[model samples]
Target: MTQKTNIQSYITIQNNEIVLNGTSVFKIEPTDFADFSKQAYRNFDVQYPKFFKMDALSKLAFLGAELLLSPITSGEQENNIALVLANKSSSLDTDVKYQESISDQENYFPSPAVFVYTLPNICLGEISIRHQLKSENSFFIFDAFNTEFMSNYSNILLNSNKADVVLCGWVEFFNDDYKAFLCTISKEESTKYTNETINTLYNQ
Candidate 1:
């Protein structure tokens, strides 16, 4: 059996961007979600040439994946990495717009482009392409942070040896407030993590 390892990282993108790696990185006020998406794409150096016209879901996925993969030091373990995410909206914002577009007969045509964002898991696809990761992926939605689910599922993946690393977090985009926090876990014991440690950090 693979040994258990846990490592943690935190990212806050609210009024400003703050990344905790023992200290704050920097902060900037994004004009909007699209602007934030563009900034992230550039930061990760995503090579996709046709990103602009992509649907909002795809755009967010692209940005999320870029953030997850940027700090990875073990791309060599691509086969053993999993992308697990939880969000509150579950693409409802996109679905709402899509439904509105079709609600009126005068503008009843629903574009396939907009329809695609209705599902929350598309972000996994964007991440897979960005990192060339072919490992397991999943997306879950709840009214609030489901710590129990996140911890249980991630532990299962690691203990089962199905993956050597797991990237798990919360990514929510609601109106003007957007927040994301991601952490990585492995089978090698590292000084960086523990259940107690995580709880303490989170409480702070």
Candidate 2:
């Protein structure tokens, strides 16, 4: 039942730049993750009030997803789309922030909004909420980008009946360094989904 999967659209955000496919979309001040994400959010003209309450990790993931997937109107089968994201830092960045918020014995104040994003998958939830996509999604932690893993898992999703599409890739953020390389996978067979292509796209 294995079938071809295509890269519908992909976006990479890093090094003070945002690129959708091979085209440069925007550039920023290259500041900290917080400030840069705020600027990028504005550049995309996203009107989500909840975006402000999201942690740095969520913001990075959200922006990348928005830059790529926002324009496409989903069909009734959108619920069959899957989300598969991986990262080296996982939620450590926000975990540290959350810890610092409660580590202080005197202040000892933990913001519920901040605490909510302690898991990396919360970003996926935010995307699901925005697009109303009810589908299978997973978050992975890796030392590096495992293109092979992503390709293989996506193949499984398509070969089986578990999913009709998958939004898969890496979303990593640590301090001022962050990157999100995300793409939509479907059986439409537009752009070939291969290791070489993903590596080239990620490096571009």
Candidate 3:
């Protein structure tokens, strides 16, 4: 018998609002991404001080992962879970800030802090560190959310035993706009993991 993968839980954040499993858990007035993220962090009472230091992309990813993975106790499922995240912008939002810091030859101030987040996968690192998920992880850049790739890749990871569960989705932050739709997949009798369902949750 083939093992079936199912979406254990899903969370979405966009337009200053956060929805988990089809319920609007948090919503705030229109504001900049920085303030919105901070408010969400406080509203959820997430106590990771390092969250404040992350770039926009990392902060967005961290918040989604934090909420989606909340039911599972930290350190309980150490290396069984994998993270596979995709985005269209690919950290360009942070790249712009980093460039400005060193753009001026005379006033060139290259910040190691900002420089570190130039890669999109850094968001994965932030989540992994927080959850202690030491397993296969990858970040892909696509013109849009590739549900086919996400479904296939996650299914392989789960079926092959590369990971007992796969947490994958899109975390996109560019300009002042941001959206995150993260989901956990495992062999459970719930929402069947499929391309259509992934698209539906993302659009929801």
Candidate 4:
């Protein structure tokens, strides 16, 4: 038994450009991830001050989730939204920074701020906290985006009543290269939720 679902809304953040539901909403000159994220935060008028303190990975995912979920105004919808994020790097960028901090034996000092974002799923926590989402969430490290797993897992959650909507996609950031393709899935009448569609949105 397969539960049918559709992508209610989708967002892509890449190449210093942001597109929401196939419409270009924001674009900036090429810059480092930190500066780009800060510019985007100001451009979108996001009021989250903690966003500035997040690492590159968390900033990327948080911004994507912010744009994609901005329309959900109801508390029930927020609580029922589950997160399913996958990435290839698995927080390696931050891991490298953490390693550098403690690499020097004589000056071995670990920054708790850097250490807190060592796990890839920490970005999920950032998004969850920002949106007050207490729903089920999971992060997977795949060689690439596992569309089948994303699609199936989201469908299962929806059919099982675990979530009314699922926010799932890929958010990968490492070595100054990054991309985020996030979408909301439910039984809504929009783009069909399938492997091909997922791939298309990701590549778009």
lDDT of each: 0.67, 0.82, 0.90, 0.89
Best candidate, TM-score: 3
User: Model 1 over residues 1-204: C-alpha lDDT tens digits?
Assistant: 545557655444444454554455545575777776677667656677767766565565555445555666355655567888888888777788788889999867879978867788877776676677888899999897686788778888888877777877777775646666666767667765555443344444
Q: Which sections of candidate 4 miss by over 4 Å?
A: 75-78, 191-196
Query: Could you tell me the C-alpha RMSD of candidate 1 in Å?
Result: 3.0
Q: Can you list the residue pairs that collide in candidate 4?
A: none
lDDT of 2 by residue, 1-204 (tens): 567677878888888888887688998765777777888888778999899988887888888887666676464545677889999998998899889989889998799988888998999999888778888888998999998898788878877867777889999988768889998877885734454456567777
Task: Note the residue pairs that clash in candidate 1.
Answer: 3-187
Q: Using lDDT, give the best candidate's number.
A: 3
State every prediction's TM-score relative to the real structure. Answer: 0.81, 0.91, 0.95, 0.94
Rank order by lDDT, top first?
Answer: 3, 4, 2, 1
Q: For model 3, how does the per-residue alpha-carbon lDDT over 43-104 read when each residue is reduced to its tens digit?
A: 99998999989999999999999998767746654657899999999999999999988989
RMSD of each: 3.0, 2.0, 1.7, 2.0
- In model 3, which runs have C-alpha deviations exceeding 4 angstroms? 76-79, 191-196
lDDT of 2 at 81: 74
- Backbone clashes under 3 angstroms, per model: 1, 0, 0, 0
Can you tell me which runs of candidate 1 are displaced by over 4 Å? 1-3, 18-22, 50-61, 71-78, 194-204
